[model samples]
Target: MSEPTPLQTLFDTLPQSGSVEWIGIRPARGEAMKALNNVMISRGTGLEGDRFKGRETSKRQVTLIQKEHLYVIAACLHREAISPDVFRRNIVVSGLNLLALKGKTFRIGGVVLEYTGLCHPCSKMETTLGPGGYNATRGHGGITARVVEGGELALGDNVQACS
Candidate 1:
């Protein structure tokens, strides 16, 4: 293999580690999310009880968002605050720029996940966050990932991208 370019080196560098601040799962479609301190991640599936179940190669086995983005979205929508559960993502993390994990594999506790794509806002955001909801979530919708390895993950677990 050839030497990596400067941009590749920069992209591979991630010294900051994030912490899982919250976890949630929906038992069924359109149902409210149930928050949990911890949960089991299943390979080729997703958060054990999450309503979504995609194929083994599915890019959206799990969804994660930045905790800080929640506040930003709220501010964008002119709200004092917005609960993480309302976003319907599987995990809310803080301190790490999730975008850095794009096209990389990362670990949360013992679970390993591969970044798949961006988790764009769906029309549901309109009904959930009121007017301008979808627009407010644009670019702040976080990223989607597929499980590479299954294990238990809990609130406070460290999230780090693999080298």
Candidate 2:
């Protein structure tokens, strides 16, 4: 029998780009909040809110990931403000599964990041992108993370995931 791979080591060890693409952030329902150096507030939910075990509160926090998860290549063509259906993450990442980044710790430009949980889609997506927004691709929009060690993050930043 082979030993299972550690959850912390899910992604390949290759130094890849698009692991941390910083897309433009806009207001979805309220006034545009200032992007703080260590705190950029974002919102998300789980599939049917099940990820939260039926909690009604929408998950909102700062998002983060490893350098390999940025997905800059994709962001350049699609742009950060593109339709919500696509992985239009305010910060499009690559290596790590944004949905599965929960509870993990990573680093971005020397700042420590703490993975929270999956960022499931919500009604706004359906309303904005139509029923197609409810498709499998849009099921869980992505995941959310908090900047434990806040710092200045910009496009093309090299993020590092630490266990």
Candidate 3:
């Protein structure tokens, strides 16, 4: 076979295995999401209790951000570190680059999730992160995912490539 592309090589190696540092599920729009130690997920239910649950048309079944990216975003705005909740992502992992999982499948605890695309920053980030919050979080917005398998995801779960 021909040599793999740089990204394909990284995908094959995946030297970075990380843990799920935080989890959040929003029950409804315009409301604060619930931070939890564990949450159930499935292809049909997405993240249990999440407002986006059962929305077949939606590809944004879950959202993830890297814990280290929080600092990067803060520095971009000349502000202190922000919490995962401020970004409204479902999971915050440390170590692995969320972008690396694009077009790949990964497991968080027992759940299988496929990276769909980048989780771009929304206008709410401006209000939540302050004047420059939205812009600061632009590239650090993290990744979006869709559940492919049903299982329980807990805090400190080992997240790694499926194969």
Candidate 4:
């Protein structure tokens, strides 16, 4: 049998580590609750097109399968983390070592989300940040997570990770 994928491994290790803090969580443009509700009701699905394939063809269309995927939290550098395009994450966290969390799961505001895979840096992020953004953090800033247990999340809530 073939070995399990990285995501599989991650799932196997559950309630790994979790944390939460008060941070700004906003919906991206056209990602308002109403919009998401419309899509969910109209399409009966939250995911949209192919995230990687449509990158070249349709910039407007979300290329990733997990469209409307919420960024529970995002971290950015106040000054040192600057780039031409803003690496604006929905939730900004500090004191948590994301690298260490690799192959582990973390909970935010009581809502558990598995770190399925690395949020790879994309050209769009480079374009938005311009030259400075390309080399910033050596492409370390990418935010992607899968919902393990769905629930209402708000800013300023305590985030914890279960061992």
Candidate 3 lDDT for residue 90: 91
Tens digit per residue, CA lDDT, model 2, 80-110: 4343224334455555555444455766554
Name the candidate that leads on TM-score. Answer: 1
The true-structure Cα RMSD of candidate 3 reads: 1.7
Better TM-score candidate (2, 4): 2
Q: How many clashes (backbone N, Cα, C below 3 Å) per candidate?
A: 0, 20, 0, 15
Candidate 3 residues 1-163, lDDT tens each? 8989997786677767899999999989989878999999978668988888656446789899999999999889886877778888999999898887877899999999988899899998989878988889989999988888879999999989878
Once fitted onto the true fold, the runs of candidate 1 whose alpha carbons sit more than 4 angstroms away are: none
Model 3, runs deviating above 4 Å: 1-7, 54-57
Residue range with the least summed lDDT across 10 consecutive positions in model 3: 51-60
C-alpha TM-scores of all predictions:
0.97, 0.55, 0.92, 0.49
Each prediction's whole-model lDDT (CA): 0.94, 0.44, 0.87, 0.38
How do the residues 109-128 of candidate 1 rate in per-residue lDDT, one tens digit apiece?
98999999999999999998
Q: Which candidate achieves the best lDDT against the true structure?
A: 1
Cα lDDT of candidate 4 equals 0.38
How many steric clashes does model 4 contain? 15
Report the Cα RMSD per candidate: 0.8, 8.1, 1.7, 9.4
